[model samples]
Target: MSPASDPNARSLVQAGFSSDPPVSNPVALRAYRLARLRAELRARDYAGLLVTDPINIRYATGTSNMQVWALHNAVRYAFVPTEGPVVLFDFHGGLHLSAGIETVAEVRPALSWFYFIAGAQAPERAALWAREIADLLRAEGGGNRRLAVDKCEPLGVDALRREGVEIRDGQEVCERARAIKSPDEVIAMRRSVAVAEEGMAKMQAVLTPGMTENELWSHLHQVNIARGGEWIETRLLASGRRSNPWFQECSDKPIAAGELVSFDTDLIGPDGLCADISRSFLCGQVTATVEQKRLYGLAREQIEANIALLRPGLRFAELAERSWRLPETCRPNRYSVIAHGVGLCDEYPHCGYVEDNDRGGGYDGVFSAGMTICMESYIGEEGGDEGVKLEEQLLITETGVERLSRFPYEEVLMPSRWL
Candidate 1:
């Protein structure tokens, strides 16, 4: 049978449908996120909020791939107490015209019936916007209104301060709302993982001895794109002696008969959900130094153990501890943390570490039903002659976790005859 018709074909084409059905409008989901932000602002006694981060902006208004830096010319969004329609200020002429097509925001152009002014120059323009923002807050009881600002690049914050606007950081509030995933978000994430698994399976079939690392890298990239991936977030292919953590990207190095080839690829769907997976393969035949059977068994056992421990109310610190202990029990030299939360970013809510900062810092938060996480674990010896890395994405549920990618995790050693 042709590879496409072969039941065991590794490429995504054989896995299932290549096309995805249309997803519902992310507007309702975004509104829920905004509600969380509003509650935070109200608790802090803030009058209005000025959101500037692109990701945060997208999270709030469902607007993606637009000029997020046009603060002075456009009023992206301003939220007032209790009232629903947010005040929008857009300085970009094109934004006003394309508002209907691009974003889901209640847009307010600078030329609207509301009080407005445009400066003669760029610096003056920014100053004017800052002044208008302060004035809006003042009109809405600015004395008691605390203003929350997101992505206040130092220079912009300085300008706002000069305009006499009181600004407080909103990073924590935003991250809190984004940390938990919704049902829709989980659906999108599952699709992203499916696309990634498809790409991996395809790469596995064609990977062979004598193929340069760069060639294999290209094949992975092509498969990901063909599967509707918006971008290949990351592509790392290392072979032979270069399969260490520090080693990244594909070089001209040829795959030796018995060497191991390890790859890490990240795929992102149009909805902005991401899936990250890493796998290792043996070319030709098994050799000394690295026992393929032993390492693969260790990796599988470690991954299974880690998955079994995933549940609601489990502390991230506890997860890290369990991950480290697996290496000692199964085989030595396993990774520190085998998994983490996946969403808009690859490392969001960085789990499995003892660090007190980043997303994993607060172990107090319980694992809820909608969160999608990636579970990864690898086994390698000191000599670095060979190793095995296996990874998969999972969805945390009310009761337990469900594996999103079911691809085989066993060690694969393509024979020379096939190559």
Candidate 2:
């Protein structure tokens, strides 16, 4: 049965329960996000803005699904000026009834609202909708002004250009605003980590030799779904020789006795925040694989060491560089980076050893409070032999870093007492 259908699943579904707390509306948190977006637009010197990214849409409107697609192909957008309530272009009909939730328009009517066009895209209708949206901006005292557009897919941008609208890049401004976590966002993310830890704990009790990677992945999905998790971001289960850092995709190979199984579980919460973690286990009796043990040890050490150094005022690239240096036990591969920013998207402000001049590469950006990062380090042999990967989620605080997920990191599975 689906988790929502099960009565026993209610506790996990509502994991972040608090008693004797001020009853704040979820809409208040949403309003804060919209206010932040407006401030970003003003700082970037735009009269108004168009937010096309899905994540940005969720940020502006509390509705998280794909209802924005109904915006008459005119780019699902929120146009906010220096002052006044924001104008939202979205589909209101059917969405409210289907989702069983009030539309943003009903919640905040002070903002100008337009519903999705009902008919097919006749050129005339498209032009009319475009003109109407532009006229709304013009009525708000923004005439022929350059507007900041966030993540406008090529087709949307071309359509707007055809309609005589000027669009400028607003990626950096949006990224800077989204990089830091809010108090509510941090709490949601910690809850996601806790759910992942619970799922991993269950996995440790059942994992054994002769299980296929797919089978293990299925078990994880079942456990997570039972705990009210909607989806898993990734299920990377690589066993034995496939445990190398280069091996990312899950395989169907059966796990054998005395082989090391390395897996990374990245799961997402209902709020869209994520938690990424990696762990390794030995299937039967412990073998004298000194290199494997040492590699795991190094990965663990580097993760902890990097966490110790994480704080405000430190450059992001410096932390990455310090963690990428391989120990004498195992050789580092060319494909992987140590860790990266984890939030609305899996890899935001990509951090690691590799340098991408287009996007600031390695250690250049300063670490600030409220940044939630995943500190991961992995080492493997040259020929895709046995390897190890260790990762954990950390919150950078004013004084120090706090580890959110505290599951055991040893190679031996505690429940079975088998290494």
Candidate 3:
């Protein structure tokens, strides 16, 4: 968004709302997200939501601190009631981290009751934690005892239950709330994708034979940190034979010429948005083998054909039924989903294959405008020595889908004629 359009953008920078570039209007973004979360709660008859998952906390408060550590530590949380103040429970000495943010109504010291903090006293401390939560609910709940918690340990759950609190699966509500993106969130996502593409461009520019996969993947990490990005979710860069089955981590094995180097940019880029695009590049300046080009071509075809099926109001089941048909030989190693929702990170509404029903996997939901998703394609024969991974992030718009990831495909391996 234009800085001139948002009068508060400049002031927010000076106020330390964020140290990175202002990619979106922070005020509107936070307000929209909070409202959305509340609506999701009200829809489910929930009195409030207790957010302990670090990612959910970020979504609720727009403040981040040691997220990876807190993922397991349980030392931070937020409480957003359907009709009351949005309270943030921050770690000790961390209240200043969200000082001037407008989404948070109050910042209080968090109560840590994890084993690391309380050990054998964990159960005792947990009772204290439960009392505080129960008191807040009694004050803010208007007598509604149902609460949705995105994440909590068994101890916390049991304690809350004993306090007459009905615990609901809060992660489901959070996912539904996060599936839709506001205009500012889309703008932020675009900027994140741009940062990822810049790093991919650098990787391609410097790619050479004999360079280890670790060396090549470091370029993405360096670019992400150097830019305003947060982190890369995986080390999914692999070369040649290692790329065949997919999901291989980057190793010290040196890449060879003519081999396909496939990678998925599971990047948490600038603005903490995820840029999840995948591409395969031919290593060095050499002609790709016919097999390499064939794999790349099939993957691209699958991406295009499946993307063509996306539109607002489409049923997930129908989309999965009509998705590009994987060849018989490649069926065993197909990607987990035809597509899946992507926002803060890879998230809900996993669009799996229609045949996944036997595995007890199927959910009915209609694709709505403002939902950003990543469509994935991976092609390789069961015993092939190489594979190609291709994916694209797109926005489901009122009219149709808008491709968000614009990183160039491997021209050398792409067929002259492509859809």
Candidate 4:
């Protein structure tokens, strides 16, 4: 059946809210993000941020070229002070790559020790990089003698320490900055959700028995790329027995008729926001078994109940306390986390089970306005090799939350007893 003709699909589409004109405005989006970061740094008394994490660098400077390469080799980095210029230490000789990015003040070579160490002569380059960073920190007002480095090589950190700079964990600053979503960030995320749901709709339209899990998985990548998304972070698509306990990466196994298929979209879209969503599907025209229906229903119950309880000012600890308890049969294989904050990727404020949260950092903080949260649940019977996984992305507002995911659930898999 065509997606539009399916009642479940129609209902989901109708319930999703989108604006008349697209909410993506690149200029405004970048400004909002940088402003938020600066605010966070100011609040934390950080002199300047030395961001080397590819994702964190992209967050600060808006340049994503050679991202994966920078992860292994610290070739690219960004330094932004609370008040002054934004600098891009461009590696791979890609200085021109940051040409028109408004937030960037200047681009310079990121000649790290790693860049020269293969030929030896490492200390020379490390000193140069350290001197450059020391100067940047001094300019940002070295009263604190502190700089936050998100991710960096040991050579670079040692060099900075020798220069008398106290290095702090920059990821903490970046996470606190990104914990809340600006209006434009929310829009970019919503746009990503729309693109992913379109991919889901396409996959649902043509699902059939005998289709390989790889084939089903390709549909999402193809659709997401065509819609301008970047990449899928994980191989989270599986079918039949593979879908059971979850986290089985997509394989060459062929799907059998009347079996469950589950997938998680760890998709990083064009706007650079990650759309981390999951849904379970029952293969074509098959009647779901009683066990299948029960598992799916329980996951839905858990998700819906938690979503209802979410509101601004609700304590994360209280929410964890109130989370649905998994039945004894399902507790052994229950997913570790109930929810986590989502932004550039699976970020801070991970809300674990009461037992897990009670350890020390129990209840990170109160849910505040403008935070984006992903509620997650996996329901698999301990001994059974089949299960269901459900997740939804939400934007917390002054009053309550808005569902950013609009993909329809599998009606056939849902228990009929549920209204």
Local distance difference test scores for all models: 0.62, 0.62, 0.87, 0.82
For 172-262, candidate 1 gives per-residue lDDT tens digits of 6666667677777766676677666666676666667898888877766675567666666555678777775424677998887777778
User: What root-mean-square deviation over C-alphas does model 1 reach?
Assistant: 6.1
The deviation in Å at residue 68 for candidate 3 is 1.3
| Top-scoring candidate (lDDT) | 3
Q: How many backbone clashes does candidate 2 have?
A: 3
TM-score of each: 0.77, 0.79, 0.94, 0.93
lDDT of 1: 0.62
Better of 3 and 4 by lDDT: 3
Residue-wise C-alpha lDDT for candidate 3, range 120-169, written one tens digit per residue: 99999899898889888999999999999988889999999989999998
Clashing pairs in 3: none
Q: Residue 354 lDDT in model 3?
A: 80
lDDT per residue as tens, model 2, 1-419: 33234454333334443211232355556666667766877776666666656566666665554533432343355555545545555444423421433224422211112233333444444455556546655665356456667764454455566766777776655676677777777776766676676666556555678888888777667765665555676668888777775556677888888787778787764466576888887776566366666667766667777777778787766776555466444544632555577876564556766444234544468878888888877767567577777788888888778777676666443222223
Error of 3 at 106 (Å): 1.4
- Reference-based lDDT, residue 296, model 1: 63
Clashing pairs in 1: 10-201, 10-202, 11-201, 11-202, 73-91, 74-89, 74-90, 74-91, 75-89, 75-90
Give the candidates in order of TM-score, highest first: 3, 4, 2, 1
**Cα lDDT of model 4 by residue, 170-278, tens digit:** 8888998888887888888987887777777767766789989999888888878887888888989888788767788999999898989988888887677888899
